[model samples]
Target chain A: MLNNSITAAMADIATAVKRYSLVGMLGWQDVRQRYRRSAVGPFWLTISMGVMIGTIGLVFGQIFNSPMKEFLPFLAAGMILWSFISTCVLEGCSSLIAAESIIKQLPIPLFVHILRTIWRNTLILAHNIVIFPLVLLAVQKPLGLEALWSIPGFALLVLNLAWISLILSLLCARYRDLPQIIASVLQIAFYLTPIMWLPSLLPGRAGTYLLDLNPIYHLLQIVRAPLLGQDVSTVSWCVAGGMALFGWCIAIIIYGLYKRRIAYWL
Target chain B: MACIEFNNACVDFPIYNASARSLKKRLIQVATGGKISSNEQGRVIVRALEDLTFSLNDGDRVGLLGHNGAGKSTLLRLLSGVYAPSAGTASISGEVASLIDISLGIDPEASGRENIFMRGILLGMTKSDIAEKLEEIIEFSELGDFIDMPVRTYSSGMHLRLAFAVSTTIRPEILIMDEWLSVGDEGFKHKAEARMNELVEATSILVIASHSRDLVLHTCNRVIWLEHGKIKMDSDPETVTRAYFGH
Candidate 1:
């Protein structure tokens, strides 16, 4: 029975992945629908992100007593990646819930909804990340071969988010208050993950271990470190990779057990 | 060769109330070993469908007749592969289009043309297929220039016309519908009915749930009467409809 359930869940995931055209179009529609009537459209998101980064960078730099020249790019990269991760986690909770109408009316795989959510957020992230290069230029950060590491780092990040979305979407569908709980958790995670402050500010060995223990910090390091022209630490890569594998294992198990229950939950 | 088979299939819905859905309450219940548990905090299971054993082969038009709380819609969902059976099994073979809600994926902010694509994708049509049927769908909807405008601006009748057009445009092996789909004025209803007949005739299998006896007699050859989540009668539409209505 367990093997059969796992096989069925795998088949569902395969079918959802095979229907990429449908998933991609739906994701594009999701992004388009949100900014339909606005004059500035989704660029409004880009503009707002830019303004937020600027304000936060100056204020936090002064507060941390760090140089704006070094700090702005670091803050910008971390903030941009954090936005992507946070939105993926937050909206991931509603990936299936938001698509309840479509789910009920159609016979598509549940993972299709998760893919659509991730893709939609990825599109929005694309819009927000346009500010990154300009910030790098503003901060006089040079482009280097090390910066290319961010490409693989981002690919891994997307893979991790996909599994995370799958698990959260199902769990949140089952438990209605989960989305709110996730939101509050992310609020705490924002401070705990070291997005605003340098890890160096922490006094000693315990601070280093504490940062190491944070999966989000490791996830952030893999992408942000490279984008800010720093070495991509092997420990960060190993932790992020391990998290991806561990997350997928949990996601697949939960999905296998609860795959059929989602429609009922909805 | 579309077919659907259910072997003693059952569906139980765990209706989670607020307290049951909350992690804190559930944890407390688990930790306290039901000592502090209230009935409301426990999971309430509703057996929506029970021991539903049936098979539908090609060229069959089956109508489901049941009271409000009976499992007509649940059966349709089961056939459409929306809800897997909690016990037993169901095997469905087909490209299925479940018209439970024709306007399900319609976006109010999008134009009728864009909604056609959106709704078409949701209906299991590929982008290229929708592109090919674009002219046919728009022509069938009879919205003319309104097709270019946001669906939010459409009158209720116009919106129904667009939804009906996009939904029926698909050619599925098995078509599952709930209730009778009605649209617009008398003229439009006749047109929609004619189009629906054409679509249904082309499909290999049709499962419809409805309270309308005349509709069942007109559209279906076989009928299943459900009472309290069990099949009470399965026979010719004439016999079941007559018995169902006590006429």
Candidate 2:
């Protein structure tokens, strides 16, 4: 019985993944529709992100007594990645529920909605990523081979985020307060994950064990370190990789048990 | 071969409150009564469908007849595989398309041509399939000049024309509809009806729910009468409709 459920859930995921055109088009339309009437359109995402990163970078650089050259690039990578991560998590929570019209009226795999959530946010990330390069140029950081590593790092980060978001979407669908609870949790996570402050600032054990313990720290490190031209610890890679595998297993099990119930839950 | 086999299929709808959803009224409010009871965990459960055992095959055109809360739509959703039965099983073979809302994925901000693709994708058509039918869908809607314009700019009749054209453009193995779809102004409605008929005729199996007695008697070979989620009667359309409408 358990095996059958898992296989069925896997089938759902597989079908959703194969329908990339639908997911991609729907996601693209989501981004387009939201910014349709605006003059600059989705560039607004780029603009706001630039403004937020700039103000935060200068303010925090002054407070931490860090040099602007290194600090701005660091802040850019961290903030841009954080935007993608947080949007996916927040929107993914409501992905299935927001699709109530389609859910009830048509027969579709539930994961497709979540994929749309991730895909649209990824497009927004594409807009926001423009700043990372400009910040690096401003810092005069020579583009190096390590910077290309962020490609794979971003892929892994997306994989990890997908699993957690999938789990959270199911929970949020069943428990109405879960989205609110998760939003608050992410707000705290945004502060604690070292996007604004340097992980090295914690000093000694705080930097060593505490940063290691937070999976977000490792996830941020793998991609952010690559973009900032810093060496990502082997430990960060392993932790992020392990978290994806482990979280997906749990997500798959929960999905198998509750996937069918989602239509009813909404 | 298109086939659907159901063995004692049952559906239980748990009506949750502020814990699972906000206190806003439900969007799927059908006229249900008496079956709203609590379970062991004290969750209010509505028995939407109970112990339904039936089978449908190719060439079947079954009409669902019921009052507002008699579970007709629920049965259509169950048949379309949207809501899995809470117990037992319904194994349906062949592709199923549910026309519960034909314009389900249509974006008002998008051009009518783009909405064809959007609604087509939502209907489970491949991108290539939608592209291939793009011209046909636009021509059928008679919206030559407006096809490139956003759907929001279209008149109400034109909107329905676009929706109806895109939705019926695909002929699935099994077709599920909430009602006999007839749209557009008087003149265009004839063409729309003809298109709807052609699509319905091409399907191997069809299940449509309706309150119209004449539409059922004229279109369906068999009729199932539902009352409070239970099958009260199932027989030939003539027998069932006569009994249902008290004619």
Candidate 3:
């Protein structure tokens, strides 16, 4: 039975990966449905995110006693990545639950729902990230080779979020209160991960260690530091990469055990 | 060729109520190792299907007749590959189209045209396939210009027409339906029935679960009567339906 389940789980994942076109189209429809009937469409999300970053950058820059030139770009990159990360966690919790009708009715792979969630959030992240380049230009940040580092950094971030979303989505589907717990945890995570604040402002070694202890902080640094024209730390890459490997190990094991039960759970 | 084989297949549903579905309670149960004695209060297990053994070869039109909660729908779902049996095994080969719930993925806020694609995808059709059948599906729905409008604006009958049109657009080797489909006005029902008959004739195997004895007798060659997850009777439609209705 154990061997059978493991094979079944792998087969399901393989099938879901093979049907990328279906996943992509469904993801596109999800974004389109949310923005239907709007004149500006998904650009409206970009506009609101831009406004939030601008206002928060100004007010928080003054409070932190930091220069607007540095603060604005940092805030923009951090907020955009944070929105992507947090939304993946918050919305990922309901990924399987929200697709209950399709899950119960269709014979498609369970991994399809996970991919659909990740892809949908990725599209919305694409819309929200438009503000990053504009913010960088506004701050007069120079284009450098280091900015290209963010390409790999962002890809790694997506890979990690995919596993995280799959794990959380399954857990949340089985346990009804998991979404609420995830939401509350993300609320604390936003403050803890230093999106609105600077890690450099922390007084000493303990503060530095605190940032190191946070996996979210590591994920943020890999992408945010490079996009802000700062040096991407080797340590952040190591931590984030390690977490991805470890997270997938746990996610797949849990999936192998619980995937067949998901339909019944729903 | 299409075939479905179930060898003593069983499905047990773990009924997780509010307390059972809570992580905190489960965590506490683990931490205390059940010493607190609240672990068993809400864990209810329902055996939806038990030791169900059956097989179907190509060109078999099997009908399932049973009272409510007799595992007919669960059995259909098992054959459709939606639910993996908890025990024993099920082997099914062939493309399957399940009209268990015609509106399974219909979005009320989406336009009928968009819904055709959405429902088509959910029903296992590719985008280009849906595109190829788009005109036919819309024309069959008979909603005309209303196809461009949101489905929420449609009346229930119109909604059923749209769902039925998209659902029947695909031809599968194995077709499974939970109940008899009867929709739309008298004129439209005739049209829908004709379409259903054409699709059913094209499939290699058909498994329909219904309570209608007359309907099953008319359409199916074989019948299986279920009682509380076990096969109560299995025979030809005439014998099974007669036995089912006490004729």
lDDT of 1 by residue, A1-266 (tens): 78887888899999999998888988998888889888888889889889999999988899999987788888888888898899998998998998887776678988998998888888998889899889978988787788889999998998899998899899889878889988999999999887888787888886866697888898888888888778988989999999899988888888998898898889
Q: Model 2 residue A177 lDDT?
A: 74
lDDT of 2 by residue, B74-128 (tens): 9999999999999999999999999888878889999998998899998889989
**TM-score versus the correct structure, for each prediction:** 0.96, 0.96, 0.94
Cα deviation of A261, candidate 3, in Å: 0.7
Error of 1 at B55 (Å): 1.0
Candidate 3 lDDT over residue span A108-180, tens digit each: 8888988898898889989988888787788787767788898999889988998898888888888898888
Sort the candidates on DockQ, descending order.
1, 3, 2
lDDT of 2 by residue, A1-62 (tens): 88988998999999999989889998999999999988999999899999999999989999
Off by over 4 Å in 2: B19-39
Q: Judged by DockQ cut-offs, is candidate 1 incorrect, acceptable, medium or high?
A: medium
- Chain A TM-score by candidate, in order: 0.97, 0.97, 0.96
Scored against the true structure, residue B163 in model 3 reaches a CA lDDT of 96
Task: Choose the strongest candidate by DockQ.
Answer: 1
Candidate 3, Cα interface RMSD: 1.6
iRMSD values, candidates in order: 1.3, 2.7, 1.6
Which sections of candidate 3 miss by over 4 Å? Answer: B35-42
Poorest lDDT segment (10 consecutive residues) of candidate 3 chain A:
A1-10
